[model samples]
Target: MTFMKLKFGTAVLLGSLLIGACPALAEAVLHRGNSGEPQTLDPSQTSLEIEAFILKDLYEGLTSYDAAGRIVPGAAESWTVSDDGTVYTFKIHDKANWSDGTPVLAEDFVFSMRRVEDPKTAAGYANILYPIKNAEKVNKGELPVDQLGIKAIDAKTLEITLERPTPFFVELLAHQTALPVNKASFEKNGADFIKPGKLVSNGAFELAEHVQNDHLTAVKNPDYWDAANVKLDKVIFYPSEDQAAAVRRFEAGELQLVYNFSADQIERLRASHGDEVRVTAALSTYFYSFDTRIEPFKDVRVRRALSMAIDRDFLSKEIYSGAQLPAYSLIPLGIATYGEPARPDFADWSQLDREDKAIELMKEAGYGEGGKPLNIEIRYNTNPNHERVAIAVADMWKKTFGANVTLLQNDISAHYAYLKEGGKFNAARAGWTADYADAENFLAINLKKNPVFNYGRYDNPEYDALVEKSYNEKDPAARSKIMHEAEAIVLRDQPIAPMMNFGQLWLVSKKVKGWQDNGSNDHLSKYLSVEE
Candidate 1:
């Protein structure tokens, strides 16, 4: 292991070398590539990909998770959890300030949370704030927005009250959707606060410039509370959809960091860079969701038959090229109560017997080998690998069940629109990366009433009750049991056919130090320093 002590002066020396020595620069350009462009820079309206990149530079919540998945202080210097577990009091860091030199006050959090739950703002992930007392009622317009439970007791102190005890509440606050915003800037700019040269940030970096769909540049924030610990002077982010081209750029020394490496590139980079090519299991599950409200799929037998006909293992190996693991359930391994090898008995749809059973079920559902082909459309985003996987599955379904399946490929924005508006498609590819280290993050979203991300509309009163019960149960063992039952219910319904667990692949230059990959695939560039 390389044991180089990091200090303020040492960081300055190394940063100088990064800017002065390498072709890309010792300044750590932090070039990143993704298939989807950042939809919005507004912390409340963006998705995970944009949020993860913006988090390094522009936002700060009360708490954050470390690389080890432990909770740590961020904007809040310290906090106290009430004995009843319903109230939390946070002390803001005295040194924290916005990029414009205004102090980041506790009232900023109050205004930010209110803005997210306000129905007019239409924050996509606003359901994440449901734990706050009366948040749901306020969001639904059943109660006034000011009735929400968060309050700024003073300039530097914030108090929050929840409807019930929630162990994951602190972790939930760490999410970008819950990050604090400057009330003054927000009121002045309204919806235009995210525009270039108009944004103010409280995180480790400040937005230097932004060119839509092309590139965004951020420089280190000198006013950040932990600015002394941040090493890089600037980070340049590029939004590119072509993974192969991104890898070419990395190989040509035009970029220093790249995410979502192609399978062929992974093999070649492993041969050359060895340990520099890193792959880790991500807390994500890619699945095919059947709109239960749509025709033909309303039948549970049809859903189960579709799930059984496809082979998850074959798709993972052939299409993913050993980049992912076959998934059997919504909750990926290593989450709460799911770390055990054999806890829940989700159906093993990959088995050979299951294939035979699927054929039988198809015949019973009035579609068989010699009957009329079950015409269906399978939708997926236009990533090279995702489209390839959809094509492979379409072929598999045609061969196994004699179902005539058509593949529809759309760009990321269009795909999201189709899912959101309930467009006509028998089935579509979808996935969820865990927001926190909880099974609730996976199973809760599928509830019938969840407005944000629940595309399938799968609902069971029994399962919903169990999810609520687990949240309040203080006993770990009891909570685990309840969550296990909830997972069983979701798998049995098969609203979504679980296909594979994602594995994140990143190609980084050897000179980048302290860039540890986490289970969530979140890259914290603030903790990284370039070495000469």
Candidate 2:
């Protein structure tokens, strides 16, 4: 959350402005600065928030979120769940079609689901589909892809059977991973399917152009089923991780909306522009994951010491300008489903007391107090704020226990890839925004069998059992209790140091109407219109 002092390059801003200043569009064209480069355009492979911003517009899943963040029908007109609640039957909207006017059939969804389950696809988010019967087995190569419990009854009818009754299955459908992909386009284009003029999507907007780190443009899809309600003619996104650059582009009148304003500039912007500066307690947490399989971190004392040494209050106040909360658990405080947030074991300890305990624990682990110093490398994605936080945390560890901490910064995509696959870093930056408004979304990532998001490689059979049991437990109160137990175990082990809960800090032009602030931090252009 810490913002570093970085100058916005005038040349880069001008180049971006030139690309977005489309005079041909007489009515409405939205200019936005995406928070970071999209990790991937392929729906099944994408995991980053920046990618979700574009993917949600370019592809329509069975369900979608309205401007209010309420679940609504998208590709499916309606769906019915069986008495057992393990089977779902969806009635596809007859008018839904690809940007090219080809009918979007139920078969398309089946193909996409199967592809995600196929081991050959190597989709990072394929585990999201594990609720479906045989999906986990298919992903592990024990079962064939054809065994996945999704089938197209006909061109307009689709049915799916789950391993158990999943209360959040409907919400899961709204996620990009559940969206359909054109099988023909997939085979024909291979890796180039999402490129300009090569993509075929069934959403309000279709891919018009994409240039790696520079920009991604989407034009209104004429063949979209509900094109009449779509207000924007074109939306241009400039991918950037620099908060200063985003703020600069927004002030220059080149961008209508921007993400992650510098902490220092927020107060100035609020005083000058007032309501234009939007800040909401987002359902997300900014944290760090430890490589639990590695040495030093393998010891519970070392992990707990590191977690206790850093001051969460300092991070929320001094660094983020009090824009976020001091998080003590995986699930953010606002989530009512979890009842109450679980306080970490060190929550009650004063800063001095925590520092004393951290020193003692480091000694017990045979590290500090004239013993061998604990050498740890902290890796994070390239962002001014991320770098600032890393520097602060490293300093805290050095001061508290005389530990040697090295900060390694990589490109956003590369950073995540290294954490998930490279397995070389001691600790890495991590964040989780609720995919659905449930604690399960945050807690499920730590499951030992979940190959997708568990970058830390934390394994506890007892903890995993509690989480797995919560899925099938029908009683809301019972589920919450089980989840709490699982969270307590995680806090005790300290696989991740819960840093700070997120408050989305962004700027939206006052001229933009119908922009609703929601916990999801969703600002889909379909619901917005420009006054000019």
In angstroms, give how far residue 224 of model 1 lies from its true place: 1.3
lDDT tens string, model 2, 256-292? 8887766767788999889999988889988999888
Deviation from native of the Cα of residue 156 in model 1, angstroms: 0.4
Model 2 spans with C-alpha error above 4 angstroms: 1-27
lDDT per model, in order?
0.79, 0.87
Q: Point out the worst 10-residue segment of candidate 2 by lDDT.
A: 1-10
**Candidate 1: residue 319 Cα off by (Å):** 2.4
Q: Which residue pairs in model 2 clash with each other?
A: none
lDDT of 1 by residue, 1-532 (tens): 1335557668889888877876644454566555556777787776556456666457878987665556689899999989999999999999989988899999899999998888888887887889999998888888888999999999999999999888889888888888877788788998888766778889888888888777888888899988988888888787766788888887887777777766645677888889878888988889999888876687677788888777888878877778888887788888755554222232543367787887787788777576556887999976777877888888877888877889888877778766765575688998888888888888777877674577877767998898888877888788887888888787777888888889887887786777777887766678766664
Error of 1 at 430 (Å): 1.4
Model 1 poorest 10 in a row by lDDT: 341-350
Model 2 TM-score, all chains together: 0.94
